[model samples]
Target: MTVILVTGGNRGIGLAIVQAVGTRVADATVLVGCRSTANAEEPIKELKKLGVPAKLKALEITITDDASIRAAVKVVEENHGKLDVLINNAAAVTLPKSTDLTDVRESWARTLDCVATSQVLVTKAFLPLLRKAEWGRVVMNSSARGSIGRNIALELPPSPHWLYNCSKAALNLATIDFRNAEVRDIPDERDHITFWTVSPGHCKTGFNNFRGVKDPAEGAEVIARLLESKRGEISSATFWEFEEGKFQQVPW
Candidate 1:
């Protein structure tokens, strides 16, 4: 069975991703990563009631805490021996309410730490277990608003959440860095691990107070498609999104 772990799987797009994998991916075991196992109970129950085929289990993981991160890795190592997929889906951002420089700085720092730095640290911690699998994949949950290309081309409107965008841009860069380090340079195909970044496209989640246009399930389709695709069918170090019933690459 493919051992898939999705951080922040307790709700919203993360939960939708778990459902997608549970129903769509064959012989899959999904680890729902959350701050507490108790936090995941309701969602797991709901998924089960909906008759999801894959095995679902709660995994306690607090991305901002080092001890929690280490503990999560240990648990997965003991239970699964190897992880086929790791989805870095958990992220937090506090929008600054004022134009004050100090407030902006603090918000920026915290957002970067929560969204980008912690994801890299978590991926690093699980690298050994990922390597133990036949084909390990890491998917970084990013946003289209983080695309520098779109920003430069005037494709997107100005937004107040600059810090969040900046953090996601850093995440995109980290995805490329991991791909270069693990897949590009490694001569042995068996040792190669793929890394990717995905934009879920403004899903209606608590993060945005339900202001987004798409449903969480709609936002999760790209990731499901990526995970289900053959290793050679998709390339690493790429950004992706699902729009208008199809998967497409997003500019960096």
Candidate 2:
């Protein structure tokens, strides 16, 4: 059976994705990772109630903590044996807004640690298991605010989110870098992985403290579509927009 592991899957976009995937693809079993193992239990039950195969995963992963990262990877590897899909959806923002580079140094670091560093640590920990899969799929949950093009055009809204933006931009680059290293380095082009830096747009999630204009269910549906899309592999790394029942890859 196809297996998927999703981080921060208790509520918001994460939980929605689990339900959408379960409803759309009946065969796949989704492992929902939560900070507190206890909190994850009910959600798993809810998924089961919805007739979706789901499991609760106990993983308190601070992107900055190496030991926790290793432990979570071990749990998945030992328990599931093969992780076909990994969704880097666990991220957070700190108190003070970092609208520019001149923001508090420590706050910036913390934001980057949770938002960007976590992605790198996750990829490093699960690369071996992903490579073992017949077809590996990784989705890096990003935002439109991270686009350099948007910044250049003064399109991104002004917020005191310095490290958050930096971290996402860094994550985008890391996504591309990872694809290049993992796919291009392999002698056989067919032995490759599909990695994407997709913007969830303005979604109503805790990420924006539910102040977003878009609905969480709609946002999760976009990610679900991507996972169940006809194309197995992606062509470029960019700001991807999901609307009107399609994914439009845009310039980064």
Candidate 3:
């Protein structure tokens, strides 16, 4: 049976991905991560209806504490034994900045912890299980606003929403580093992990709460496609955009 670990899977794109993947991967073990599984009652019920093996793992976002990440990993291991796809999708970005840079630096650090650092930390905690799979996939749900080719090249004014921009930029770099690590650092010529930073585009969910381009179902479907890629057909360390069941190479 295939196993998947998805963060922020209680709502929006997360819920949509769970639902879509349920219909496709019949025997897949889906583990959804949330700050409190108690709040995830509604979605977990919906997943159970799909009649596939599904579990909820608790993960508090405010606590970037490594223990939280490990607890989540422990749940996945106990239930599924191994991890195949890890969707580092739990992300939080504040609304367009309304304050001075100095005042917002602290908040920026918090965003750094969740959006950037947590992605790396959570994956590291679960990587041991990922390596157990002959083919493992790690997808970092990222934003194009973090694109260095676009934003750093003066494409968008750096002053608009500095905090979110910086966080995503850090995430993109981290995704690249994860790809290189998974590919070149494995022992004895065994490397099966393919890492990517993918953009959900303007997904309309509580994260933005209907303030974006596509609905959560539409956006998460893209994530499903990437996760189910055929063996040996790899897309590692790249940034991908979903467009009508096809991919557009988003600038990094």
| Candidate topping TM-score | 1
Q: Per-residue lDDT for 1-252 in model 2, tens only?
A: 667777887888878777777677547877777777787788777777776754444455545678877888888778878778888888887755544655566677788888888888888788888888887778888877788888889877896666688788898888888888866688775567778777777778777778987776677765676777654445634457675567777456
lDDT of 2 at 207: 77
Task: Give the count of colliding residue pairs in each prediction.
Answer: 0, 4, 1
Q: Each model's TM-score?
A: 0.97, 0.89, 0.87
Stretches of candidate 3 exceeding 4 Å from the true structure: 49-63, 95-102, 152-159, 187-190
| C-alpha lDDT score of every prediction, in listed order | 0.94, 0.74, 0.75
lDDT of 3 by residue, 29-137 (tens): 6777678877667777866776645443434432267877777777667766788888888877655254787657767877888789988888888888898777778
Q: Please state every model's RMSD to the true fold in angstroms.
A: 1.1, 2.7, 2.9
Clashing pairs in 3: 205-209
Minimal lDDT window, size 10, model 1: 182-191
Residue by residue across 1-252, what tens digits does model 1's lDDT show? 999999999999999999998999999999999999999999999999999999999999999999999999999999999999999999999777687999888889989999999999999999999999999999999999889999899898788788898899999999999988875578986688989899999889999999999999999999999998998789989999998887999999
